[model samples]
Target: MSENLFVKWTILPQEPPQPLLYCKRCGGTRNFRSSGKIRVNANGKRVDAWLVYKCMSCDGTWNRPVLERQSVRSIDPLLLASLCANDAKLADRLAFDVEGLRRWAPHLKEASNAVVARELLSETPARPLELRILCVVPCHMALRLDRLLADELRIPRSRIHALEKSGALVVFPSASRALRKPVRDGTKLLIRPPAEDADWIARSAAYGDDCP
Candidate 1:
């Protein structure tokens, strides 16, 4: 059985959404609105609201304030996975280990937050082969199925299970037909893409996904 654990933390001072107003630079009545949660100091002394907005007509910048209060919630695996899916930066920061946790725990975060890593033994006559592939997509690049396949060697989610059912996509080592799982950190992925794809991959890979 595999075990998992997740570390929990809270972002305090919930922020409420605000309305847009006219821009002085553009003299335009229409304005864009943006919002973000409020952050408090560690000592719980200071509090502030923050938001970023840009004018549509003249490309002007606007900042707004939010005022609201919220309570803290427990951190769970599902929430962590959602964070990983939507915001890699926050996911990297919140994930941590729980000592003495079961190995097969479903909520476990990756060890050392190394989402991609493999361990192989050579002397064990017949050792399991674990291969990990990490695909880094640029934030600016649009997500597309074909682009994912050409780089990650994994079929799109829409075709993954179907291909596996028909025995078209086989897992390596055992030749079992299945979609290739995502690669975590520390795993070497075979990257083969055209010039344009290479450019995006190179740019996204420049930044380390792990928390600082």
Candidate 2:
């Protein structure tokens, strides 16, 4: 029987990416924070909407368009109402839309706080562990797979490299270079640790609040 342990990890960005935009009032580029507000304008049957952001340095307001000249009927009623009410979650989703933010703030600065949530996916500990990584939200996180593993497994990154080279650590899609690439949702990692290192892996920070 193959003893394969399965675990799942969800990567969540703690905060929305704040776009760095030029603030006319501040006379320079400044980080803009989501004001958690939406502004809408109606013209005929067209609706235009924007998520409002404010410059941290001077409180200057900038409207990042969420929808432009969209047909009123095409908009979901609940979403439309949420926009009208300035719903926090809706505003957050829009704020995290890096592609949308780029339209206006072409040179926008983006960052993220990568918070990982882990779960045990199997009842038995297999000889080789198959770890499934799921991203909970979309954001520009700088986290790399190797870094996350090092932090979670409480092991040195060099150890991770050795495992990869020895074919003990296998990343799915074979062609994927997860070690150096930014961690993405739906990436899977298969790890075969040395028997002596099993205890250390079992006590990984993934199971505790002592995240590194």
Candidate 3:
């Protein structure tokens, strides 16, 4: 049996989704920006919370509900305090919550286009390297797997296509158009490098280093 090596890579998408809403003050649809403020209200034993957003053009305020009426005692005091204090980190994280934003604004635009950070998480050494790629998307975005690999591996796109054609690279849940498709989490790629490039590929796999 051929030796099997394993390497794990993680891809993190870095960008926040923007809310597209109709600004009453502006009299047209415009993007809204996160105000980093949480509005909280308490009535008897119940509490309500909302994430505040403001129209970019007119600064009109819109409240995105974070929580409906609920028992105050059931909520974490620290989280409640963070909401009252307008925690920047919490607000920033919520800015990426596209699903939440969609409830308030039917059409939301992304503040920035998706960019990725590639990280080599782990590797088990052996003769042939089977790479496991985990893609963590904070928002709804699409990027081709081939381009990502080409850039991360410092290899040419044609080389990747050629390898796939020759059976040197095998994608799990294999799709004929896998390379062109958007990458999803838990995708596995098994690579059996050709004899000519085995040593170079092995070195790259061992170090998880991009070509210089």
Candidate 4:
């Protein structure tokens, strides 16, 4: 109806995905979390490294290989040093690797928990009629797009669906089942509401303190 009020939402997943593996002590499959420890072994010119994982149920441990007898010459010295020193950031990044976690277990119990950092990318209007949200994900997280919007807007997913049904909410640059699936980078949403509802939704989208 007017120049869109553009806003950016940066989402960061809080927890890493847990790999479910059978634990003999627990007598069943259990989730394993990263121990934030790295083990490196160097034999001649070959190097092997792993990120340690611990079973949540029994304190049992598993090692996820980061390097497999790689040639020292082929590896970056900095990366090798980080692996040896047990760099927390490097370990966290590796631990959050959902695709890599698939090696141990095809299915993972991924956390939907995340924090959204919002910013206004365009000028605010006195009576805003349109709001566009741009989702920015630094790393892959398992949070659904609708869940994210509901969380930030402080509303129920059912309300979001209602808006969609009324043609007030439009999700673009997305495929089918976008709402049910995990949020991805560059996902955009356009919201157009009646004049009376525009101000409230805009404030909520921008996280205004006065929002209902």
Candidate 5:
């Protein structure tokens, strides 16, 4: 491989997955979004905590239990304090917990849309260089790797497949077909575009730019 140009792409899912639940007010199954709040109740030696969710249709509320009737002594002090304070980070993490939400309902609706923030590591080289991208994902997302690349690069998924087949684009952990899989944290992609196409791909990977 020649000298490489690097870019870090952080993929953040726009919203947490919504669990479809029977809404009493709506009289039907409705999607619930996180209210970004925590509800805590203290009853003598026991404590209860829930991450609050609200119905998208009618604003009906649901308390997704974080913990139920657990002794305060068993709880970590920092966690308990953060829950009491309704810490934004903690709430966000809870909201993205699709597995946790599954305990209450099996049906889930997830937003595949994401915000991709890219930071270019080096200037364009005199010669075409290997374009390396590190995918930094903070939470769960429904978007596929191929879909993301196609959208960001303004190229069709078929183009990506062609590149992979011709050995121009290399995705890490060759054991799996990650191109079609959900975008994951810490996945690395290396693009060795032919000299003719290298410059355009580098620019597109770093920002939203139309190639000449």
Candidate 6:
């Protein structure tokens, strides 16, 4: 069995606060910030103070304290839309077994393009890891490579592919010659980690550039 089959893990921060504004033009909730000043009137007297902001969402203006401006944040409606949109897009892309592909094909294409762009920007460029493993027949049946790794092992596809490419994976075939071929439906394979590649794997998992 190859060590690559064993899952690698990592932690992420908790959820962030939602943005408050929505873009009127696109109906997106993500509003980019614009600078201005607050105007106030009290008891027939006019006062100009505080920093004003223009919503990326609707181009609306609002006032807030200048001194504490760093604490302010806004939710992006576009981001929320993308999240909901991506879910539907993923379902469509993986729906090869079912009908209605035509109806969702356009969305699937758009989503895929967006995802690739995001991944290119977001994913750290790293070499693959390797793992070794042994297993019984029939255990690998009826599963997509990504699905199986994510479900049974709780690892991600990107990591798995990286490990595979780097020769960190060693699959011990079952007694049957048929089991020796590339993993297919209903085959059981054991996954193990290559001791030598541990350091490389750790380095590959490091963080990359910040989002724009």
User: What RMSD does each model have against the real structure?
Assistant: 15.6, 3.2, 4.1, 2.4, 2.9, 17.6
Question: TM per model?
Answer: 0.24, 0.82, 0.70, 0.90, 0.84, 0.23
Q: Whole-model lDDT, candidate 6?
A: 0.32
Model 3 weakest lDDT span, ten residues long: 110-119
- On lDDT, the stronger of 4 and 5 is 5
TM-score result, candidate 3? 0.70
Alpha-carbon shift of residue 152 in model 6 (angstroms):
2.4
Q: What is candidate 1's lDDT per residue for 1-212, written digit by digit as tens?
A: 21111111111112112234567788866434332222222124323322344455666655433212322233344543443243434322222212211121223222211121212212211121221233332111122323333333323455434443554433333322213433211223323323333333322222113212
- Per-candidate Cα lDDT values, in order, are 0.30, 0.74, 0.70, 0.85, 0.87, 0.32
Considering every candidate listed, which one attains the maximal TM-score? 4
Residue 43 of model 2 has an lDDT of: 90
Ranked by lDDT, the better of candidates 1 and 4 is: 4
Tens-digit lDDT track of model 3 for 1-212: 43455555555545566678888887888888888888889889998988888898889988888878989999999888888788988887777787778887878765433355555555444454444445554455455778766765557889989989998877777887998887766677777777667656655544545433
Instruction: Report residue 194 deviation for candidate 5 (angstroms).
Output: 2.6
Ranking by lDDT: 5, 4, 2, 3, 6, 1
What tens-digit string does per-residue lDDT give for candidate 5 at 1-212? 34678889998888889999999988898999999999999999999999999999999998999989999999999999999999999999998887788898788887799888888777656565788889998877789999999988778899999998898899985646879998888889999888887777877887755333
lDDT of 4 by residue, 1-212 (tens): 34668889888888998988887777778999999999999999999999998899898988888999999999999999899899999999999888887886786888799877889888777778788999898777889888887877776899888888788888887577677789988889999876766777788888645453
Task: Please give the lDDT score for candidate 3.
Answer: 0.70
